[model samples]
Target: MIKLSGVIITFNEERNIEKCLQSLVNVVDEIVVVDSFSTDNTKRICLKYNVKFIEQKFLGYIEQKNFALGHASNNVIVSLDGDEALSEELQESIITLKSNWQFDGYYCNRFNNFCGQWIKHSDWYPNKKLRVFDKRFAEWKGINPHDEIVLKDHRKAGKLKGDILHWTYQSYSEFNAKTEYFSTIAAQAYFEKGKKAPFYKLIWNPFWAFFKAYFLRLGFLDGNNGYIISKETGKITYLKYKKLRKLYSNN
Candidate 1:
């Protein structure tokens, strides 16, 4: 059977890191954690497992992940966030692939938990992520705070059978706080890339964001939590463009 290295990036992930590590311990050959020198019990907790934990500066999401990938001893990799764990089925699927490895990479649907409830629809459910791959063919790409794996030279990936259990948010307050934080980072990235936030987008984009998630994507099927999620989904877009406009106006 082939071995897999599980790579993860973290910063003050004390509240969630342990579960993340526990889920990975059985599936991967070795867990490589690249931490951002958190002043919490993060490091101590990680050491409890057989992990090759490395501490580094708090680079952006994409950068730090690539750094961790570089530290991995194996070419085949299984990546996860500090707040995410593999569902039992996903863990089993990965185990099967260890012996019968296929495809240049693999895609898995993410099942996100919000406020203790599992969101089944909207932009959250079946959230496809290419987290397992042969590192030589694929690498991390996409914008800051929204990184994705992009296989080189238009390579295609196959889908796996289970979900990446994402403990996305424990409370609306926490979600809102993260939304506020991500909006700024995304806006700044747009600003640096010379992307514009025209008035039309500021007006229509947020509306569309809500419409797509709440109506088109069947967010309502998730009930009250759906409305709250859809509402904030739009807010994320609104705030991003709003902040992007502010950046340009002040320039």
Candidate 2:
């Protein structure tokens, strides 16, 4: 059987770290947590479990994740965020996969819990993430706030049944706060890549974001939570482009 090493990056994740660690107890042979020196009880909680806790400087999302990957003792890795945990079915599927170890990587659907609601739509459900993989074949890539694992070659990938339960936000205020922070990072990333956002995009892109999430994606099926998500999605779009425009104008 292949031994799996679980890795995660954390910063002030006291509220979610325990749950995240507990879920990995049965699935992974070892757990490694790379924290950005959280001032909260994150380290204390991590000590409760048999985890190798390393305090590192605050690197961007993609960089931090790659750093965490380096601490793993095994090449077969199960990477997760501090706010995410494997569902029971996913744990079982992973356990079985470890016994057989067929594909180079495994992708699983993530179901996000937003403000106490298990969002079924709003482009949230079936949020496919390639979290489990062989470190030799993949690396974390993409923008700051949104990082994904990219395979080095045309490696074989497989899907697993079940979800990665993502405890996204506890309140609307938290959602907004994250949006503000993430939008800033996204704009900076875009600006660095020589991407520009004009006035028309500032106006039309947000409208299209709302329409696509709320209408085309069938977000309405989630009721009030759907509306809030769709609205926030549009707001984030506006913020990203607006910030991008400001960045270019200032230079």
Candidate 3:
């Protein structure tokens, strides 16, 4: 069986860290947590579990995750957010995979909980993430706050059963705050990449975002949660573009 190292990066994640670590108790061989010097009970709660905790400056999301990946003692790594945990079936799936070690990378579906609602649609369910992988083959990439694992040479990937239970926003206030934070990062990333948000795109994109999520994606099936997601999806889209435009105007 291959030894698996579970890695997570956090800052002030006291509310979620314990649950995240508990879920990995029997699933991985070791747990490594790289924290950004949280001044909260995040570090205190993490100490309750058998985790290798290290503190570092607040790096960008992608950089911080890559930094956490570096501290893993094993090459077979399972990276998860502090707000995410393995479902029962996912734990079993990983346990089986550990015994065989078949794939270089494994993709799993993530089910998100938004404001106490298990969002099944609204572009939320079946949110496939490549969280488990051989470190030598993959690394965290993409813009900050929207990092993803990119495999070298476009290697073949395997799918895992079950889900990563993502405990997302528990309130609209939190949702809006996170949206603004992510939009700022996204706008800056776009500006650095020489990408522009034209006037039309600034207007039409949000409308399309809402339509795609609510209508095409069948988000309405989730009721109020779906509506909120669709609405916020548009809001985030608008904010990203608006911020991008501001970045250009300021120059």
**Candidate number with greatest lDDT:** 2
- Local accuracy of candidate 1 as per-residue lDDT tens digits, 1-251: 78899999988889889989988899988999999999999999999999998999978888888888899999999999988988899999999998888788999999999999999998888889999999999889878889999999888789999899888788889999999999999999899889999899987999999999999999999999999999999999999999999999999
TM-score of each: 0.98, 0.98, 0.98
Report residue 172 deviation for candidate 2 (angstroms). Answer: 1.0
Q: Which residue runs of candidate 2 sit more than 4 Å off their true CA positions?
A: none
At residue 212, give the lDDT of candidate 1.
Answer: 92
Tens digits of per-residue lDDT for model 3 on 145-214? 7899998997878999999999999899999899999999999999999998999987899999999999
Measured by TM-score, how close is model 3 to the native structure? 0.98
* Global local distance difference test of model 2: 0.94
Shift in Å, residue 161, candidate 1: 0.9
lDDT of each: 0.92, 0.94, 0.92
lDDT of 3: 0.92
Descending-lDDT candidate ranking = 2, 3, 1
